[model samples]
Target: MSNFATPETRFLIGATGSIAVTRLPEYLGALRTAFGGSYTVLMTHTATNFLSPHAVGLSAERVIAREAPEDWPTDKPSRLAADHDIVLVLPATANVLSAAAAGAAPNRLTTVLLATERPVLFFPHMGTAMWRNPAVRRNVAQLREDGRIVVDPVEHADRDVVTGVVATHPALREPDGVVTAVRPALAAS
Candidate 1:
């Protein structure tokens, strides 16, 4: 067990982009089981297409979606930041990575990121080609330089439906793996 695996630890889960967002329930359940901590979920507009806020709420103390500012549980991003111990951007899309690297607050999730002094962990998920893109590589480097923990996505074999050809792609780490990474990521920072 990790030293940080305490009941009082608070986790802010920022869900971004597609596919991997569908596994949020599993992720939340794993975190709750591993750390016995409270969880709050913040979703990007695109995340809504993958999973509903109510689904996320089933495992979280609070759920905030970017499109529905009226449903925000906190008055400001800084307040939310102050309340949480760490920020985990799961399924971090290239868009959010670029935005964070540039210090742009174009959305609610990014706004909270900008306000938080907490350790930020990014678990990036994208195609192999996109993950290897020059701009994406630069953004990841910038985020690391800025003191954020960016976990490299694991390689997974993905099959193309049309061609029936298998290709290795950058995939989100399993929930347990992510929970395990958090400790070292925090310790390093």
Candidate 2:
């Protein structure tokens, strides 16, 4: 391992089943504009549903998709943490938020979340009702308490229903050198 400080930062974009996935191209463009030569991106399966791997791969200058161990040369574990500095989960869904809060690592994205020692940033997007759910609230609270950066979503009228709440705007700026540490909430019996 190299002893260099401030290795080039790569973004791990873990998107769940949110409409926000549709905006990936813009997000990727923004990231490229901001970080350009300094970032690489990895995408989640659900995100691929909205955007093609080729598009994201072209934008990031590398392949973008899930990383499975069985895939071997195609999906190496090291790729998630290799020469990277941070993991940012944009459009994080309630399900993923709950999984992270519960320390579950069932899928590739969640598994990467568990493996990365770098700072984690979560930008959650979902219905206002779901955001306010006790479980989601607890998860958000826990993630915040655990030293993860949780960016607040901007509320707006739902395009689908025309009256209900939805997350319309994105939190775009990237923070520098933010670190969050997690401590167990309770002592083991």
Highest lDDT, which number? 1
Q: What is the model-wide C-alpha lDDT for candidate 2?
A: 0.62
Clashes of each: 0, 0
Which lDDT tens digits does candidate 1 get at residues 16-133?
Answer: 9858899999988887887777888999989999999998999899898855667466546878889988899997999999999999999888998999998999999999889999
Give candidate 2 misplaced runs (Cα > 4 Å). Answer: 1-7, 67-70, 161-189
TM agreement with the true structure for every prediction: 0.92, 0.74
Tens digits of per-residue lDDT for model 2 on 134-180?
98889999998987777776655445477554545433222221111
Q: Which pairs of residues collide in model 1? A: none
* Cα TM-score of candidate 1: 0.92
Best by TM-score: 1
Scored by CA lDDT, what does every candidate get?
A: 0.87, 0.62
